[model samples]
Target: MSKQRVLTHIDAAGRPVMVDVSGKAVTARQALAECRVRFPADVAAQLRKSGLRSAKGGIVDAAVIAGTMAVKRTHDLIPFCHPLPIDGIRIAIDWHGERELRIDCMVKTTHRTGVEMEALTGATVAALTVYDMCKALSHAIVIGPAKLVGKRGGKRDVGRVV
Candidate 1:
């Protein structure tokens, strides 16, 4: 018989609770998350014409910096996330199409818990930063499906090749 997968963030009393990782062994962990921003066609044309820059400055460059900061501060933003020393964080922003911007955030740590939340937060915030910077051009920008694309270490690895 297969065992049922129990929710890790819940207590025996059925209350929401943070998972305890104190007894778990520390190991190298990495997670990758992504978000996509879709801008209006005219806005994209203007951005490309400007070499992907806006009056505020380079859009992709600013997103990378904001994503890195989000990775380091994830625990502060999410109540259940454990504070871990991030060994490294890399954020890449690229164009998926003429009107779509893709943001990927990768985070690494040596900790008992995985850094999936950190990676997700990083990507989401970076996408938000892009929207904030480009709002002046149009209010029709769309952001997300923000998601964890990969994760490694802890009990199991998930998504793409680790």
Candidate 2:
């Protein structure tokens, strides 16, 4: 058989289409995504000095909650996405050196499709939340690109990093 094209989500005319996963098996799927945010030296120093409190109920705590909520509602936010019952979602935010912050989101589900989107959405939103909170300190905040670090389940597991 000729190599099958990766156009399941597109029609012969190349228009966007949602793939039908009704026949796929329900198996545990997991995905990890990450994003980074850079802060000005002064802003980073201020944040580190203030500890976790910043009139927003602990910056890291709020980010984790926001990221988890985003993961669960990824389908609602993105059109044409199938809503899946998420088994678990975790968001971890950490200081990368003194001028950058890293956000990582891990999503787990037993569903027909993988949860890579959920992980990506979670990480991106968390990074945005950080930017929003720190913008008061400096408009120089920069949110970097978000990428899927790893995924498992579905037709084949993907371990490539971008």
Candidate 3:
């Protein structure tokens, strides 16, 4: 039989456990994550004309702040995440096409563990925030396909275009 891939969060006893990183050396690590928000065509046109503003306020600006906050609090949100000092976080929100907005979040830190979760959390929360702010325009807005695009300085470095 083929061996099962060991999960970092599971121990021999098959109990959940946080991965121990105490013995690992601190290194500069970074991760990039992205998510997309799709709006109805007419709604997208209205937003473009309004400079991407909602009745609440600036949609992209609010999402940026929300994403930054989510990066810092990722450990709190995900039970297995280890809290690390965030060195930097950059969030960008832009149009992918006439009807879709793309949000990318890049996070950097010097820590024993990787920051993929933090990056993914930031991007996911940012997309959610955009949907929340624009729901007044229409409830058909879709947020999805959030994923880590790249990670560096871990046991491995991976890059995926999706």
- Best model per TM-score: 1
Ranking by TM-score: 1, 3, 2
Q: Please, what is the TM-score per model? A: 0.96, 0.91, 0.95
lDDT of 3: 0.94
lDDT of candidate model 2 versus the reference:
0.87
Q: How many angstroms is residue 110 displaced in model 1 relative to the true structure, after the best TM-score fit? A: 0.7
TM for candidate 3 is: 0.95
Query: What C-alpha lDDT does candidate 1 achieve relative to the native structure?
Result: 0.91
Per-residue alpha-carbon lDDT of candidate 3 for residues 1-162, written as tens digits (9 for 90 to 100): 986777889899999999999999899999999999999999999999999998999999999999999999999999999999999999999999899999999999999999999999999999999999999999999998998999999677899422
Per-model lDDT:
0.91, 0.87, 0.94
Q: Candidate 1, after superposition: displacement of residue 3 in Å?
A: 2.3
Clashing pairs in 1: none
lDDT of 1 by residue, 93-155 (tens): 888988999988989999999999999999999999999889999999999999999999988
Badly placed stretches (over 4 Å) of model 3 are 1-4, 160-162
RMSD after Cα superposition, model 2: 2.4
